[model samples]
Target chain A: MAGTDTSKEFMFRPTPAIVLCEPQLGENIGTTARAMANFGLWDLRLVNPRDGWPNEKAVAAAAKALPVIERVRVFDTLAEAIDDLNLVYATTARNREMFKPVIGPDEAADRMSAHIGAGQKAGILFGREKWGLNNDEVALSDAIVTLPVEPAFASLNIAQAVLVLAYEWRRAALKDAPLPFAGDEGEPAPRGQIVGLTEQLGEALDRAGFFKTDAKRPTVMNNIRAMFARAGFNAQEVRTLRGVVAALDRRHERPNPARLRKNDDEQ
Target chain B: MAGTDTSKEFMFRPTPAIVLCEPQLGENIGTTARAMANFGLWDLRLVNPRDGWPNEKAVAAAAKALPVIERVRVFDTLAEAIDDLNLVYATTARNREMFKPVIGPDEAADRMSAHIGAGQKAGILFGREKWGLNNDEVALSDAIVTLPVEPAFASLNIAQAVLVLAYEWRRAALKDAPLPFAGDEGEPAPRGQIVGLTEQLGEALDRAGFFKTDAKRPTVMNNIRAMFARAGFNAQEVRTLRGVVAALDRRHERPNPARLRKNDDEQ
Candidate 1:
């Protein structure tokens, strides 16, 4: 149940507490906790949940997110809840009727990163499941974090809201490590291999009378070279293409009209 | 229940079908529906759901996600569900045993958006909750959608995965809405105002003994101006910061013993 003990890769980084304000149902809270846990966030704070604390419904909903559920900090008021934090961002999908500085999820995540880097506490305030953070709560927040949903139907589920924000936060924090690309792990085929493959292909094409006109020979060679260049053929692909050329060369060398019929039709 | 009639804002856009392959629990199906609703998606096709169709648990969990729930389509296999779609992306966290083009959620969303823009159908495959899409099923997809989660704990819950992918899809689809910034709507501060603010700040800092060395004074002043130049201060923020500087300047003009003692002690 400990914060650092449970968090996986981002255990060292400071994560914002998810404060649920006056949540009506226990199921949504459980679902929200699961969403937070999915993104490596554990701190859960509840401000005046309607059904009160220690609801079994939330526990039932949280499958492997029991750690987040166990350490939930219940608060009597929103002010008392956020007083310990240096910064707070109120989340609302609807365009509010207030003068607060509104920020998107990415920018909000960046600000959270900056704050956490400075060792300052930051939190995201989620309003009641029915009505989002009220005007007064929005006024208390330093800035507003709004999801970039369509204006026609911007109503996001509470758990969905938490997931989006948590996803952005985790992405911003753990962004230094680049994703592993299987293809990029391999080195590009060497110049020698490309040359060998090109020569073999040229020989094969020449045997098939591909470069018939002397005037168009240079243009055709350039086109072949450009095709190889654009293909970015790896060593294995180059070897396979070379084998194909060899197979074609042997067939063209031999008077096998039945096998050469496909090549002739393609040409 | 129809795709166009139900899809909230993106009615005109070609929406992708959410194909769940051998989903075990009905509750997860409900949660997935809720998540899809949050992103304005209504097309859901279940390929061999364990509990069969018209699941009461799914209906109960999906709060006001009636549009997605009502229009749910049941298929006998993955092939039949995705036969109508021109392109399909398989969502998988693990590096599969098969060779397939892996793309992050954002890029997958972009490709989906592009396909939709070209009047082509695209669908995403969600595997079973316990075990993800097998290699044979993954091989059927044109590309794989991998979430950027920590490799240590990359197992995201079925609904969490759905929300993340759906969120990205909606973001890529309806990206015309400009992100809300406090200063983006306002005009940027004119060069004249920036110069005035820079001079004002410089004078205030100088009075407060910011530039201790005569030799470094010009360099420091240039650096300060450059900082302001890079800030891209809007008219309102510039005036506000200038006001703050002016207030500080007034307080520093006549240094009280207490303030001077604090400053001197600090130095």
Candidate 2:
């Protein structure tokens, strides 16, 4: 897909607004914007940046993701930043025992997708660089999203947190199921047809006396069947194997009286 | 393994040492130390810090990685930092036309491990915050480690750079052989033992008249051999399978034709 087209279709889908409340440093803000850009999330709302609006350092630090910072909306308060969002998820490392249900990044992403699809604007609020969101700030959100980090050191950089959440969100939004059997997008043959083909192949082998020497004939045959089943052979693959076996059988139809001698020599 | 014992055994094991050249901020140094810890590398040499040695900010920023900082040795200059090192690699975004090879972090890690195994002390030099190592400093190394970032914005924070290189180094150092098959450390059973076991199993099957169908003879036999081979059966595993086969054969010695038919039906 072309970059612009891919962006437009999923671009600016704007499932969640990233609200940075009183961000301390320009470099961190820039990195956070860059992280947002990774998941195609560009709608950023800044609440009282320390270095002032349109900070040069933030823009410089954004690197390839400067577009995200350029398009960010400046707001005076966290409430103003998330005013248009219907569903808000406040991110924090602290376990405050807020009555709201807590979820991980992936789960939050899944919920975010459903909410956005239902035409609701969702927002994720990030606290300042040093201390995370305050009690009042976290209480304002509909739910809380907490990342699982080492209990001894649960603190994560603001940008790293944004990146983790964005990655999960993008994966959920862009996932597609793998194709079955035939390869690519080909239609999968029915299970009954595949099993029937296996039986046909087995019978042909039986008529050729392939199971003569093996004492645990049933176990050996079952194992063979399991192998074919694991391969998930479609109708065509089974037919191909059968044809090759049939051809071989016809070639070896005339049994030699010296077959037992030849078998010993081969061993 | 006990951490200290494992650490001691591999203490002198050669690794790529990270040398920060006059790093200004303690937080960056702390983060860099944290990155080094991630890759199981504890050797850190700091070239004169602007804020002086053992900054509290660095310790706080390093968080749980204070042990790394505790062991860090401060130096007066780049030469002093790497005087004892046999191979030195300096990181730079600039593509210098010097004769030394320029490699990515992964490649550098691989090379470092190989050299380290040969008992060579390898070091990587990282420049300061404002102005990276001057040309003189860059010229002090054997090779340059550069992260492939966008050409428009290639500058990465010192700690972030350390994180990437450290990650790649640890991955290379700990790379193990594919599993289920024991690696080089474990002794494999002799080939004769495996073959003898297969033959015993095959003889038991032959006595049970498993090779009844002529056409299936080769396929069935070959499949049986392949199944055992894929299981990577050791001498013990082969003996166990043989015992199971013998027991089954003993039970079915009377060979009720109806029972045989039922076994086929079960399959």
Best by TM-score: 1
Chain A fold similarity by TM-score, each prediction: 0.84, 0.64
The C-alpha RMSD of each candidate to the native structure, in angstroms, is 10.0, 31.7
Residue-level lDDT tens digits of model 2 in B1-267: 001112222232346789999999999999888666644678999999999887999988885675478889999988898999988888876655554556766678899888888888898888888767777887898777765432333446787667666656755675652211111212234667667766777777777788887688778778877776765665655667678777777776667778889999999
TM-score of 1: 0.68
Q: Which residue pairs of candidate 1 clash?
A: none
Candidate 2: tens digits of C-alpha lDDT, residues A1-267: 001112223246554788999998999889988767755677888998887888988888786575587788889888888888988998876666545567766578889888887888988989987777888998898777765432223446788677666655654565442111111212335677666766776777777787776576777778877887776565666667778766766656765558868998999
Deviating ranges (above 4 Å) for candidate 2 = A1-29, A34-65, A71-267, B1-14, B177-267
Model 2 lDDT on a 0 to 1 scale: 0.70
The per-model DockQ list reads 0.13, 0.01
In the range B142-233, model 1's lDDT, one tens digit per residue, is: 88877765443355777778888887888788777674223223566898999999889888887888888888889988998899998777
TM-score attained by model 2: 0.41
Best by lDDT: 1
Query: Distance from true position, residue A256, model 1, in Å?
Result: 15
